[model samples]
Target: MEEVEVVVAHRDCATLRVGAVFLKIDSDQSRTEVEVRAMALAPIPTPEIRWREPPVLALAALPGRALGRLGHPETASSAAWVAAGATIRKLHDAPLPPFPERSRADLAAEVDGECAWLLANDVLPAEVVTRNRELADPALRPWTPVFIHGDLQVSHIFVADDEVTGVIDWTEAARGDAHYDIATLTLGHQTRLDDVLTGYGPGLDPDVIRAWWSLRCLRGIRWLIEHGFDPSLPGGEIDILKSRM
Candidate 1:
C-alpha cells in the first residue's frame, strides 16, 4: 500500500497524497466546489477528478513536476517558463466567469489594514511598510477583468520537456486583472518576468506588475504570520519586498 503523504494542513484545509491520487479536504465545501468549476473552465491542462465527497475531493496526480518553489532556484528552462506564461495567456483570453473577485476598494482597505497591522506588530520597520504601501497604490486603479488563476505561484505550475503540462490549486481562481496573475507568478523571481512576457505578448504595464508585487507581499505577510510561515526566509516575501528598496 502507498503511504499517505501530507501535502498541506491548516485550519482551513488539508491535502494528502497517496501514490497517484491527491485528496483535498476543506473546511468550506464552497471552495472545493469553486475549484472544481474553475478547473472545468480552465483552457490549460488540469488534474483529472478521480472523485469527490463533500469536504474531500480526490484528484489524479498530474504527469509533470512543479515549475519550481519560491525561496529556491528555478530549474525549469526558459522555454518552460515561457510555456507557463503562454498557458496563462490562453486562460486570460477565455470568457470571464460569472462571479467577480474582490473589488479594488475592498482590496485597498485590506492592504491598509495589513499595513497598519505590520507596523503595529513591529513585523517590519515603518519605513519599509510605508514605502511598500506607496508602491502598492497603483494596483488599486481600474483594470479590464479577465479569467485568472488567482494564485499562479511557481509551485502551482507544472512543466515537462519545456512545455507546460498542468496547473493546480484552483481554489483562488476568479475574474481579476490579468496583470495580477503575471505579477504573482513573477514575484521574487523578477528576472523570469521577461521570459513570461515573451509568450504572454505585449501591452501589460510594468508599473502595475511591480505595484501588484508590493500589494501581494504586503497583504500576504499577515497571513504568513498567522499561518506559521516564515516570509523572512531568503527569497521569501520579505526578500521580495526588500528587492524594491
Candidate 2:
C-alpha cells in the first residue's frame, strides 16, 4: 500500500486552511494512478463567509481532481447537464437540520460586514453594493434550510468519461434552501444550466429556479467585489451581471 503525499497547504474562502494531497494507487493495469485528497486543517475562529457555529466534520477528501480552474466555463451535452442536475437533486434530497432562527435582516447584516470590508478596500463600487441591498428580497429567501453545497461551480464538480464522477468540497456544505445550491451553479456557470435543470427532474418550479438564479448572481457579485480581480471570478460572470444591471 502506498501513502498519500501532501502537496499544498492553503487557505480557502478566508476561513479554512486546506491541506491537499496526492494519493498513489495501483490501477487495474498495474500502473500507478494519482488521486487528489483535500482536508480542512483548521477552523477560522471568526469565519467571514457566515456566522454559523463550527462545522460538523473536521476533514473531507474529494474523490477526484478539480476541473481546471475554478468557475471556468465548459460546454456540455444536454445529457451531461441532466446528470449534473440529478447529482444536485440527490444532494438536496439528503436529510439536513433546519436553519437557525436568524431573520433575513440578520443575515443581511452579517453579509454587510463583509461588504463593508470590500468597500473600505475599494474592491467593490459603492453603487453596486447599494443596488444589491435594494434588490434583495427577504421573502424570496428561504426560512427553512435544506442541504447546500455552498460553492457549486464546475471546478467543484468532477467528471470522468463525460460523466459526473463526484462532487467535492463539502467544507462549505450547510443547511439552506435547495435553490441556494442550484442558484450557485446556474449563476456561476449558466452555460451548463439546461442540463442541470433537465436532471433536476420535473417537479421543480421554473419561477423558483429563476429567482435563485438572480440571487446567485448577487452572491457572486458580492464575492467579486470583496476579493477584487480574483482569478476565480469568470469574465463571463462580470459580463452577465453588467448586462443584467
Candidate 3:
C-alpha cells in the first residue's frame, strides 16, 4: 500500500492521497453528494471518480501540478492564468447545478455571524474586522446566479505546459454569483487579475468582483484559523483584506 498523504484534515472533514487515488472522508454527506453531482455536471475537466461509499469518495488524481499556491507568486506563465480564466468562462457557461441554496441574504448573515465571532474572541482588530465587514456588505446585493466552482483558488486549478489540465475540489461548487469565482481565483494574486480577465472576456462588473474579494477574506479568516492555518501570514487572508484598503 502506498503511503497515504493527508491533503487536508479538519474538524469536519479530511482528504487523503494514496498514490494516484484521492480518498476524501467527510462528516457531511451532503457536501460529498454535491461534489459528485457537480463533477457529473461540470463541462470542464475534473478528476475521474473511481468510486464512492457513504462518507468516503475515491477519485483519480489529475495529471498536472496546481497553478499556484495561495500565499505565493504563481511561476506559471501569463498564458496559464489566461487559460484558467477561459476555463472559468466555460464553467460559468455550463448548465447550472442543483446545489446553491446560499443566497446573498444568507451570505450576509454568515458574514455578520463570523464578524461577531471575530470581535467577541479578539481574533482580529476591531477596526480591521469592522471596516472589511462594511465593505463586504455590498456583495450581498442580488446578482444573476450561475454554476460556479465555489472555491476556484489557484491551487484548485491544474495546468501543464501552459494548458489547463483539470480542476479539483468541487465540494463548494454551486449556483452562485459568477464574480465570486473570479474573486476566489484572484484573491491573493491581484497582480494576475489582468491576465485572467483577458481570457475570461469582457462584460464583468469590476466593483462586484472587488466586493467579493473583501467578502472572501472576511468569511475565510475564521475558517482558516479553525483549520490550523495562520491567516496573518504575508499573503494570507488578512493580507488580502488589507490590500483592498
Top lDDT prediction, candidate number = 1
**TM-score sort, best first:** 1, 3, 2
> How many pairs in model 2 have backbone atoms within 3 A of each other, for residues 3 or more apart or on separate chains, i.e. clashes?
2
- Tell me the deviation in Å of residue 17 in model 3: 1.1
What lDDT score goes with residue 140 in model 3? 83
- Candidate 1 stretches with Cα past 4 Å from truth are none
lDDT of 1 by residue, 110-136 (tens): 999999999899998888899999999
- lDDT by residue (1-245, candidate 3, tens digit) is 79989998988899899999999999999889888889889999999999999889999999889999888866989999999999999999997888855977788988888889888988878888888887877778888888998999889999999899999999999898888999899888888888989999986777788888889888888898888889899898888777766
The all-Cα superposition gives candidate 3 an RMSD in Å to the true structure of 1.4
All-Cα superposition RMSD per candidate: 0.8, 10.5, 1.4
Question: Residue 103, candidate 3: how far off, in angstroms?
Answer: 1.6
- Candidate 2, residue 41: the lDDT equals 18
Please give the lDDT score for candidate 3. Answer: 0.88
Model 2 per-residue lDDT tens digits across residues 149-203: 6667666666544566666554455566666666666665555566778888765
